[model samples]
Target: MSQPPQPPQPPNEPPQGGFGAPQDPPPGGFGAPTPPPADPFAKQPPAAPSTPPAGGYGSPPPPPPAGGYGSPPPPPAGGFGAPQGPPPGQPPQNPAYGYPQAPPPGQPPTQPGYGFPQGPPGQPGMPPQQGYGYPTAPMHPQYAAPQPGGGKKFSTQMQIIVAAVVAVLLIVGGGIVYSSSSGDDGGKQDEAASAGTDGGEGKGGEGGGLADGTEKAPADTKSKVGFQLPHPKVTDTTVVDGSWVTDKAYVKTGVNEIVGYDLAKGTKLWSIPLAGQVCAASRHMSKDYRTAIAFQEGKPSAADKYPSCNQVGALDLATGKLLWSKSVTSASNGDEPVRFNEVTLSGSTVAAGGTSGGAAFNLANGAELWKPKTDTNNCYDMGYGGGDALAVVRKCGSYDEPQLTIQALNPATGAPLSSYNMPAGVEYASIVSTKPLVVAADVGDTAGDGSSISDFFSIDAATGKLIVRISADADKYAADCGSTEVEKCTSLAVGNNRIYVPTEEHEGGGEYGDTNEIVAFDLTTGKLVGGRADAGDRYTLTPLRMDGSNLIAYKRPPYDKGGQIVSIDGSTFKETVLMVNPDDESVREAETSFSTNYAEFIYEKGRLFISEQMVSEPSKSSSLDDKQFLVVSFSTV
Candidate 1:
């Protein structure tokens, strides 16, 4: 379960040999992470591009590498577990992975995406300092122009997975600033109350919001920066994990309040004050733009660095109002309200679970539906997965040897209609989907790559039977589920009775660089569906969410290019470019800055909004003049 070897650097660039040379893979362990070494290219300047090609931004990609995914690299000296790539800090020695590539003699430095840049070499004797800044001028480049194409060929050994990272963005001076206006239309605010239809209880959890998340592709996909929120300075790491988009506004969690912004213009609309910082937010939004959230009981004090996350509430996204906020006491924990770890929405119910146990309430008025009780067997509901159907992860037995039961619950009565017992030695399991009842877990501490999955359990939620068990090799697949948060999984989309995942990045089929694909696995048969959507040379695809049966995926930008959003057909596996961000180095930097794993990505209609899940004090390397981004929005015309 060691980290897979890093792919070889682009064949074109010379290797940087020195103190940060490749090291053996870190000791293998399931939970412990090897500290990343100093980034060798931290001070490196950004490479420049050469002359722009006449084909322009939307030009077709070069022909794929000769063999496609069918060509697999030879195994490492020590086989699959051998450390791959450079040790954590050392990126592959290639321009594609951010290393500078000097152009042929006599050529002037150009921009990155359109052409290669050439610069003078480092002075004699001094350890070469990698250059880091791109040319100040901006250049626009179109992305994967839509075209008819056949499905990408796949390797029999290839598996599907998705990976994302979360990081903060540093906005320097003279950057693009979003203009804001007041979103105070009282008439529209009133109409927001009845915006969504009743989706009715027990249908399933995946369907919510406009189009049930099936955003229509706009005719024009060209996009530019619509707006941005300067990162808020904070005393300590503060959680601001909630965000929702409505027809009238883009709502998000601020320090201790919920604020709404104009969806198109990034204007300030309205705010709803909360008792404390938001700790957990529901991924599901009611059709009417209503959602659930969990927050701290009070603001943190010097004496108490972190307060208990005990409050549960519902927010009316359209009107910008806190419909209800309530907490409950566990019989086993006496009078204090239970501190919940996660919250979710199921029809009219708001469910929250924590160490103290599980509880539910009416989504409309916060009326208590059920609360945890003292159990003779010490069984407690660890948490829940909510949406169309409500399911609970109930833990029983003793702390040393726990037994987990995944139960499909009655959203109205809190009764277990069906249940599936997990295998032994499985301490934590995440519900990847509730209605389909897919669960992911690192069975026996086998997935050593930090992705909390070794296998997937496809269960019949209506009958409490295991339909299929898909074994996922950590090194091959890239999906992840939070080790502790039952409902917090990303990089994979479940639809059409199949689980779609991206393969971990690998050497590509083109000369450009690393690439990945989106593949599907049958939920009922536990077999690969033999279809893939290639990210195409230098691009890596990460499944964001589903839009109806279609899968919406984000293509991480290559070193010199801008990022892309594409919609893949559920049946055909063909990709249609949705929004192609500008390729200007600074814009690409700002757009791709957020770590994929921790950032909140919401793409709808033709707009993509990326926000931080938590914010903290700036690092020592940060300058006082540096501005952080709270939420950056992009839109297509």
Candidate 2:
């Protein structure tokens, strides 16, 4: 439909004028009557001879006499040129002036009623009247009524619509901002959903809804919690080296000293000082934590003399008395005296492997069970897989291209279970075994110069069959590879269904900084299953024990900042840091150097007993004089 027309302007307003000026009226005045002129451009006709009618063949009737020539047109009626009056039944023109003027012979003059205002008579330059009649009253003022302040006012419905639109915009914009701000929180929620809540208190517990109809409150509101470590009594001052906790006692080794303490009261149970001064290398406790076997290296007598012999001693857990002691001939072959790096006890079998060779002894009487011939200069570590199965690695061949040959043997009979020849070019390597699976890590080409190659391999522990080999850049197969230029597995702690591997990365030419990470792998599927646990620079991780669904680890930061006990979920690999050493805080200066090492771990009931060392000294120490042994307990939440 078309819109309504706009109101007209007032009658007194003049017509707007612009670019073209209006022409003046003809030469005669506007009201003067004149005959129509003939067309100037019309064609002229030829002149014709004078002709007379037949009946009056003579010139036109003689012109009427001067006085008879229409009698001077009757003296022009009223005046020189006045108009005649209208005939009967006709109205006169110029009603306001009461002057009558003749109309056409038959038509009547229209009566003047309501029309446009005319200009006063005799006005010199007025425009002609328009054909349409004017309004009787001055247009009745078409504008709307003035508001209180003469401003436009919106209708009630329009105001409501505008308010609703603005509200919707605010709601949409707020949702976008909230989602962007909570992106990380959303990822945490996803992780929680997949891993399940099993660490903190009240996190997975049930709660009732409040009266306001909101759901149960969040668990973080419960309360904050802290931890404390049980103190161990210090007996005699000694250069403690190795320590391990059994069910009822703690055993510690020092240079020429081996001591045992009661778990309940911290009283000295017994001490076995060595005959010849020596440093303890490694120690192991039986599965029941009732017996311990320690390996010690004999000190050299003179610069030219080779170290005498390596010794392994068995001790009773409760009484701290020696069970048996045995000595093996040195396998040094003109090198420095050999030392063991790992000793393990399983049931009645005790096994030790070192730079000398790998050996298993009878736990009943300290009798040599098996001693393998040495082809390598060193055997860094060893692991026993139940009954008679033992896994060992020996470093052999040339110094430039050292080879680590992994072998599974019957410890009781010294018979080979299986064996595999590893690749050359690796300098250091370690092996771990779990009945059916064996994993080995080899680090090679320590001189850098672009010849470095580090790799990990998995083997069937039962049959010594190669399963898979993983490289440092094998993310899909081994996602926990270290980020350092030299990537190798540092420690292995195995649980019932999973294996925990801690790897290290050394930065800055392997001098100043180091980073540690722990990765959990599913033994059955051989797949990585959890997020990497990152322990910052200069920190090292050692697996302590794996109990039920949890794998406990000991983390050592640089320079004796003490140590912390970290609990990792076996399934998800989520970590909870717990039981940090409290005594380290009492040291006087921040620049002092300290060292703390986790010796062993024993988990019983709901408590964890950890044996460790607390050593503090200057950054440069002339002698090992400031080390102390400690045993502490941590309660599972």
lDDT of each: 0.66, 0.41
Kindly report the root-mean-square deviation of model 2 from the true structure over all alpha carbons: 44.4
The candidate that achieves the highest TM-score relative to the unseen native structure: 1
- What C-alpha lDDT does candidate 2 achieve relative to the native structure? 0.41
Looking at model 2, report the run of 10 residues with the lowest lDDT sum: 15-24
- Candidate 2 lDDT tens digits, 506-556: 221112334445665555445454455544444555565564456666555
Name the lDDT value of residue 590 in candidate 1. 62
Off by over 4 Å in 2: 1-239, 277-283, 288-309, 330-342, 354-358, 373-389, 395-402, 434-436, 446-453, 472-491, 502-518, 523-526, 530-543, 554-566, 574-584, 587-637
Per-residue lDDT of model 1, residues 473-514, tens digit only = 777688977766688888898999989887777655332356
Q: For this target, which candidate reaches the highest lDDT against the unseen true structure?
A: 1
**Cα RMSD (Å) per model?**
20.5, 44.4
